[model samples]
Target: MTDPKSSRLLDNRWDDAKAAGLSESQLLLYRSNLLGSDKRITNYGGGNTSAKVIEKDPLTGQDVEVLWVKGSGGDVGSIKIDGFATLYQDKLEGLKNIYRGLEFEDEMVGYLPFCTFNLNPRAASIDTPLHAYVPYKHVDHMHPDAIIAIAASKNSKELTKQIYGDEIGWLPWKRPGFELGLWLSKFAKENPTAKGVVLESHGLFTWADTAKDCYLLTLEIINKAIAWFETETEGKAIFGGAVTQSADADKRKAVAAALMPVIRGFIGKSESKVGHFDDQPAVLEFVNSADLRALAALGTSCPDHFLRTKIRPLVLDYDPARDNLDEVLATLEASITAYRAGYAEYYERCKHDNSPAIRDPNAVVYLVPGVGMITFARDKATARISGEFYVNAINVMRGASTVSTYVGLPEQEAFDIEYWLLEEAKLQRMPKPKSLAGRIAFVTGGAGGIGKATAERLIGEGAVVVLADIDEAALKTTEADFAKRYGADVVRGVKLNVTDEAQVLASYIETSVQYGGLDILVSNAGIASSAPIEETTLATWDKNISILATGYFLVSREAFRLFRRQKLGGNVVFVASKNGLAASPNAAAYCTAKAAEIHLARCLALEGAEAGIRVNTVNPDAVLRGSKIWSGEWREQRAASSHLQVDELEEHYRKRSMLKLNVFPEDIAEAIYFLASDASSKSTGNIINVDAGNAVSFPR
Candidate 1:
């Protein structure tokens, strides 16, 4: 049992906000953070809060009321003052009249924008009117998981009454719109003593004259629901035991390695976009449970989840222990076909004329019973958000099942929200994503200067990148740094000695399992060896050939196998040097290895042409800045050979180029990105020289 005193402790912490004499808007912001900071209260951008404050109307020189509400797409936990959209109260209240007669589409396009008070252009949340209609000075709305468990239960009405008695108004599952707002407003008027309103199949709403009171009431009500659920479900066998002891790590990875690419290929056939995949522990637990099919078939825990997870997750028939890869993939294909057919029928049964065009029938979340759950989206961020919500939904549904039967919104109600104009507009409002939004990229030598730069560039363009390098320490540091910028899901690090065939093959398999498949492979790993033919030791030549020549072959071979299996065209980029095209004196081993690497790329290009795979090479010359090849004794020898000081070598290289520009790591990175992207789609078996203007090294 949660201590009731714990609720008091939280309330006491808010006394500091009151002591600071915060303005109404500031208090609302502070409390919004307080509510949003707790995942139990809201997840991601799931909730909104508002404050009614009196402000001077600049044009009229009179004090008028304004509703400051959480702006669209703004998370309450991190919202600043500007994150709140300000609206003229009198103007917005008048919208209720126009809303009554206007169609939902018309209201979204015409009326919502006209009611704004401030010059800020962010669209107010769709739930704006719900806050405007409420008479409280402070109102908070949250989709607390605990409350959702109760609100989505079959016995929600009776449960609501038992929990809050007449102090709370229970509104049935009505599609959120002008009508719903009006109904809630009317209910508050009739039930004047009610402290909050519970929207069935939705969430909770609490209000008070002060932000502190409103916040405390929300926590109080949510705690009540939690206590009730804990008491009711105690000793109940709600969750089934695991179907089998969790598979060993290698087995789980092998299952993902075999299944994710095929699933990705199947889904990609329906849409010509990049795909994303995730396999978190929560997903594994839920999917591996014996009751997965029974629980998942019941649909999403709430209507709002449909926006992220869809109506139902597609459950594939997969048993890691008994099923072979080919059999699992075939079964998955048939399951997807059946899912589409069922989705089309469901749409026909529920869709109205105003409904938006049907979205693709592919399920966002796929449950592979023995392996885990994999979520698909157009980008990594959305896939992760969908995964997070599904995990929460699973927990809520499990709790609801333990107490009373779990019940989601009816199909028509889900359709009404899923295709709602306001919801669709919110998605349309987002800025266009980068060109490589859902693509996966693998960079060898990723801990080195050029490789790190290329990985960062790919991530900036929105590709999920896997950084593989023999240097484990550097690889870990680079991964951690990239995670700080993009997120852990955006960049993964793998220790890879590219010359080791087993490690090379395992890296590709891991990439396929983690991100469905690879689209771009930058084979940039190599070692620099400079020696005259007579003086060159066998060790020098062998080491250079092993990493520079043989490493490229190993990694590329694995990449080719996976690309052929996926049947999706991919890009391969070889990072050769200008010396490869025009040899430098005393650089026999290095030049020979690079020349071999370049030729290997052309051969792969010819072999991959039929599969639509494009192979290219980037030859960068005198890349002194951040170039590991130009460090230590090699720098002295190269400078001595050119009869220049160590520091002057960079200037010499700069002047040597026709453009007289210093070639930095980023310059090489740009060339690699161009070749990897669709910009060079028509060009393959091509070499891009990043040597400024190397007339001698320029491709014929």
Candidate 2:
């Protein structure tokens, strides 16, 4: 149980917050504080917190309860009322078990009630159920540092008992949604006296009848754990040269005052609450300790903690004698490898069910030979707090490693947290997209015709396009043409053959770095080759598919690598042909390749949707302007061969489409432009027809 003395102030603070009138700004501040404490509880935009506010319902003719939770892309630390999507609490609760044994559109989860707001409220956070499950005026759910650290250890249950004693309860990580809520409710019933519950590998949950109580109780629990750690380690608090501070609060206040300006400038914010940073003397001394090299290896305790602490921190030590920076980095590399290998071994031994295995470390820690440790947090304050926690964790682990091997939570346990329901529920939180401004795009085969059109249109619409193609001369000419029209930086020319894996990989590396990162990929490169079915040769078929289909794969895969790493989300567009839908006589190999291209794009769309990468195909009918197979000589020969006039040949193709308008290269280009822009943000795995409606003659 928590020592009453250590938690006395926390309990008092709960009453104080409630008395503070819960203004909008205070509610936001309180939400930030509560969510920022745990990495899994919330990451860049993971879990959400809400306050029950009464509002008049337009349809009901009566005042009703509404919930205000963080909106689509808003971070909790500085989330305003605008960031929270206001919804009728009753309407949201009704969805808990309505569609049992079915999966509706994940995006539609909040659409029902969102349509009722005065200003269309943004989509609600996906884990709205978990937030709703807790019967509290103010609910706070965070993957707490102490809780995660313990949960991630091999003997997590034992660690929980040793550190928290009987103060907190534990819940096996389950998938989030109605099921998790049901699970928690059942567990709570079984342990009525529990202060809060720890969702394994997921996060911590602590709610009160009031927001203030929730906040204070959370701190009380954390402080109790901190005190226990200190007592076990006999860690001494350190204080450095100070201009003269009589009290601990005074010292912390001065440091916060100095640091606030720098942080504000870093984030471009003028107003921010400076959380008091009373760095433990033991932490400071440990950061300056001789074993700093050994301490830098521990990564973050959980996943999705990047927004706060970042992937890793620069560990600094003030000692000038620490000259082997390479050795320090090398040790870090070794530790990371060991960590992954250990995780895999744990998985092998513990995994007996069909559950998916852990993928990556949720967090990474870095120690500077002479500098202090840095921890990964999703926000600035969280990162700062993580640094404080890292020092403590480091001291304990170092001492513990000496006693017995510091085994992390076994594979099964880590997988439970990594794939925890609450964590997965965060995946369900799909925000309505805003504009595509500040995004980079790269279009292959972007010299002339459709390729040129795509590059030009994308550039005109505010995207920076890296126009690449195997035709070096064409690429240069296109670059010159666009540069003269849109300035040199609007479009850049890079010689690349998408069919060549090395070239494709190089192009991605160059473009990603030059553009800060890639946001859109347009695989518009393909050569047209048409022949009678029996006349098509193996070499010809291979050549067509290699560039038309496999080439798209290489470029798409390379883009996926960078997009996944950056986690900014991305879009991919394939320039398939109308031949994919309906084949014309004498076009066997070409039609086959085009059909394969459409299916490939669909599969990528399905796989990448979860990562926020939208994949779609643009199928345009025959555009005579730039196709290699539709030159002036060929057009005239085809007209004579078919015993029809040149004009008649063009007329026949144009009339094939329902729209009956000549489909130019520019027309196809526009379709690609729309797919790449924010205008079609919700579109994915869709095949848009730019054939002037010709391909619709026969539907799949």
Candidate 3:
């Protein structure tokens, strides 16, 4: 019986698409989105879909049959019509005769592009031929976790026959290319009544005359297999939950926090390599599973996954209570060496004369029993994607094991896919990431204008940021908004009042426990006060000093403490003001507090220098708009002191600068980013004046 949940999802999507009056291409797009929206069905770029349509050739103005398939590098969920590469069916079919018996690489590189019907240059998916060869008008292909579990099992063909009956054809594992397409075409002709085809150790394919029919058929097969696995695994314990006692949890956090920097440093020694460590709930669960060592030792479930996660995950032995950090590091270094040696051996076992050069020997997924999983790559996005895929694969393995003995693609097959020339080309085609690809940053007052702007800038450069603010409502809103703009893993929010020493310490502890450690700290929290020297009350002066000066000291102290414990160098950038550099009339409280904060940074820089921590200050002038400090009675007071109206005060400040440029919060953020990154590595105890050429506030 089809699973009710799966049936409901497919029916709702189909009905909605039809109600929207979608055309065939639009319906296909809608169907692809439905499949891609669920990671259980397909990951970021792991699937393909297509529809057959007749369109007029631009050059000849003649109607011709064209197959529109999902193009490379486009996620199915957000794909548009242009994301489908149009190929003439007749031209694509003609390639069968021209490139018969060609190697996979030669066929893909030489004859594939010639089949395109349009001048638009997007490359078609490698499985485009399989879609075209099917007789049906619509075709869907995806690596659904359920379907993969069954397909990658020990006796895949027999299990597929048991679940899908004779209506499903089983194709042996073959590299996706001309040969696989030809084999599929032959199978379809022989078994004309087959509803779908299962490619062993790869994925599933379903085709029908309509898009809805094809999509529903795909879902039905996957759901049926899942139901069978569930029934078979009833009352069986496949894996145990993590040991979550308070002491165990504390030990896990401590080990993870201490070991992450060492692992990062080891991997980052090479210029081309970088590493990111994550212990999210799913990773922790997987690492703590009772059979992780045995299960992870098996090869990857499918060939496509091998391109992202290597053939086998590197599993490390770590006992939080028994193993000291130094001992763990030594063992980890030895394990990494063994992993590299094993990879080299596997390459030698599989490589032929035509094989591509071996890829870097770094393992994408690292499994630590108590500490959790650490994913590594040259950049943050790849590392995250790898971790996500491994989590899905772990679930697949558990389900498969409960039903029968779990098996995966053989080592040789995995090697072929990992070193494929097309995969290498895809990597080469991607643009280089920013310098801070895997770094973590913590920004105080992040719900405010300047702090939010700085956090956004850091995220743009590929840093994972934690935003701390005292305003609970605004903090939650900003966190949700940022998660929507970027991925949820990119930015997090913490409710913190920097003036409260307890809150400040708790925020840093949470940062270390969650993300392993912090790399950059932007101390941007402060309050502004304006009063003549004689009129300023003691309370007013203390309030300004407590937040502006004392707050900076508290956050910096915690950050430095964490850096010393982890033994990794870090960066701290203080957001001071131009008022601190040169006294502004009638703003004695704010000016004096900022001046104290600036000196605090300098003193910290002196002490932190020996530990390789760099500290600096950025002084911005008159960022009037979107600034909380420039609002309320302070705005009126500043305008009155400048002899201008409130609205005209902004323009007056802009024109006062020698550059005549309006300083925005983003300008200050850029200055802070420079000091926080390696661009200003050699310089510390320094100040950058971002006042749009304010001569009086210039650094001496």
Candidate 4:
């Protein structure tokens, strides 16, 4: 039964556990195992699962019982009842707002012993407080891999709306523990009929009068998600695909046996082993896919899978045409190092002083060249479930390709999600102080509203921002205002000509040394010189190229070198105008340079992606900054020469954009931040328009 059940057996186990009359040990094991079934279901034990038991309370006036919940390191699948700490139900409910004086990192430790008298051998699930707050008999907290896959995607809430369509109530991603539970209790109170509440990016919660209903509801909800995804993406299988070779039953069994121990180690089961790669055509095809390792390059379906899948799959790079163990070993070692480095970087990016950093991968999948896929989990159950999620994610992405290219979340957004406090709280430990924190990002043309606003947002997110412009007086005046707003370390003022390569390079070095490293480079320095095609001259072209094209390259090159040497992925933003995309009348040279810089940014985006470095360009249409070319006097002079009024000049340009709102530097910065963060790991070589829908007219 388990063999055929594979990943689906989890649903059955939950049902069977309840009917069989669970032992104290069996009950704890059942809850833990269920929680471990999905990485998203419980990450580093981010979620909590509990069972009610009858017991005597000495101080109680009437007879009452308690609940035993999973404690620290007592992974759900293997957890014993002894691993569960008991807390009196009434006392647990009475202890409200116990988190006031406790540090978030230590909150788990401080609260565990206070709520339970049995002295749990492990730390209580952080959400124990929330579980106690609710009136339900059974409560389960799971990140629910399927749920997060939908949540972390672009406009996930809207996607959920399209999928579930009022089937579930969705909440924004928030810091978990006390607040998360409180939020849920309040929400549950408001919506009395919700079957389950979907916590965006966090996970899902379900409850019922009986454990069977709750367990079935878990499947029903996830299956609803599965069905919704299927209906919306009709005929697109998340995992099923074509295979290049026929399955050899003998070879399959041998492979499964060889992988059993490793698989069991991962999912925490011994008899569990690899199964069904033989039954699935896509699994076979994926193993045979060209550059299977490269295909595995996609990040996990969800972040917690990073704990199991170890961030990516091991590419079988094995030569089906010939045997190559040395090459395989070399590739394996390289993969190990790369994975470790990524973990290290994540640790440094969001680590907290009190928590120990994640030092090793908890799970991995092997992608052999000719052979099919093999995944490792603490037990066979986890491995099988994770494999399904991976296979499904790959298929969905590939199928989505048929409809249109898959565009990932913007980089900066990915960074924000990956490093978000709520998500970070799910982990047992976090990274130390951010290595990139306090670093200053100097953006030229900072007096421009977009540049200024980008600086402001980055400062607020914890990075120091330096505003630089050729307008020395404006720089100094703006510097004073920002310094007052963000404090001395968070804001800086620099007056340098980005057009001067020496000055740009000097400033880059000085800024790096001053802040320990340059975290962001916003090359917004440019001048626009408009001329009719007939009157265009070599001199006019040189001037535009000098500032917009050449200067941007020089500054970016210096920043890249510094970042590369430091081995930290720094972000770079280029401020090009929409003229780069569609030509406007009498602006040939300016448009050409802006277009060239735009192309340069694309090259950086692709080349810099692997190093964690990012580069993006913003093209705003009608930024009314005081450029000598776009100044009122200059416009009036040109309009008089053309026998047109000044108002006509403004109308002509304003009407060019669809929305007719003048584009500003702030608009550009919003897109720039999206490209700069880790949230956009899969996004690069993309251009975002800040022109109030002007790009729609570009003949797409």
Q: What is the TM-score of each candidate against the true structure?
A: 0.93, 0.42, 0.90, 0.45
lDDT (10s digit) by residue, model 2, range 1-700: 3565753222333345454777643664565655554442344444556666677788767987776666655667556656777777787666654646324424335444643354645666555666655655666666544556555455556766776766677776554555566566566567767767776645677666656666677776666655554455454322212212222433333323222222222221211111213344544454555444443334334433422333233443223253443453335435545545665665566554554544443233434322333333222334445554454344444433332233333334445545544445654564532244345688888885888888777777656678998888878888998888877655667899888888886676556333435678988887766566688799988998898889988999988876675555679999988888886666677788889989999999889999889999988776877764566455665566467887787787778668888888888888888898878999999988877776353446
C-alpha positional error of residue 11 in candidate 4 after TM-score superposition, expressed in Å: 6.8
Report the C-alpha lDDT of model 1 over 1-700, residue by residue, as the tens digit: 2456544222324667363878888999989998988777887788899999999887888999999999888889989999999989999888766554435534643576787885768778777878888888998889887788888889888889988899777988866666766777898888889998888878898999988888888888888787777778778765575784456668777777777777677777644334344456766777887778888877775665768888899887766677566776767778888898998888899888877788888888887765666787887677777877787788678777778888876777787778777677767878887867778999999988899999999899889999999889989999999999888888889999998999998998788766778889999986786667899899999888999989999988888887777777889999999988997898899889999999999999999999989999999988877766777678888888888899899999989899999898999999999999878999899999999898888776
Which predicted model would earn the best lDDT?
A: 1
- Candidate 3 overall lDDT versus native: 0.80
- For model 4, residues 120-199, the per-residue Cα lDDT tens digits are 45556555666665556666666564565565554666766766666567887654466666677787778777766776
| Model 1 worst lDDT run, 10 consecutive residues | 4-13
What Cα-based lDDT does every candidate model obtain? 0.82, 0.60, 0.80, 0.60
Scored by Cα lDDT, where does model 1 land? 0.82
Model 1: lDDT of residue 414: 81
* Alpha carbon lDDT at 606, candidate 2: 87
Residue-level lDDT of model 3, residues 516-579, one tens digit each, is 5677999998788777899999999989999999999999998898677545678999999988
**TM-score pick, better of 1 and 2:** 1
Q: What is the lDDT of residue 280 in candidate 4?
A: 58
Off by over 4 Å in 3: 1-12, 16-20, 100-105, 239-262, 269-286, 319-334, 348-358, 370-372, 378-381, 484-489, 509-516, 561-568, 584-588, 640-645, 655-661, 693-695
Residue 203 lDDT, candidate 2, scale 0-100: 60
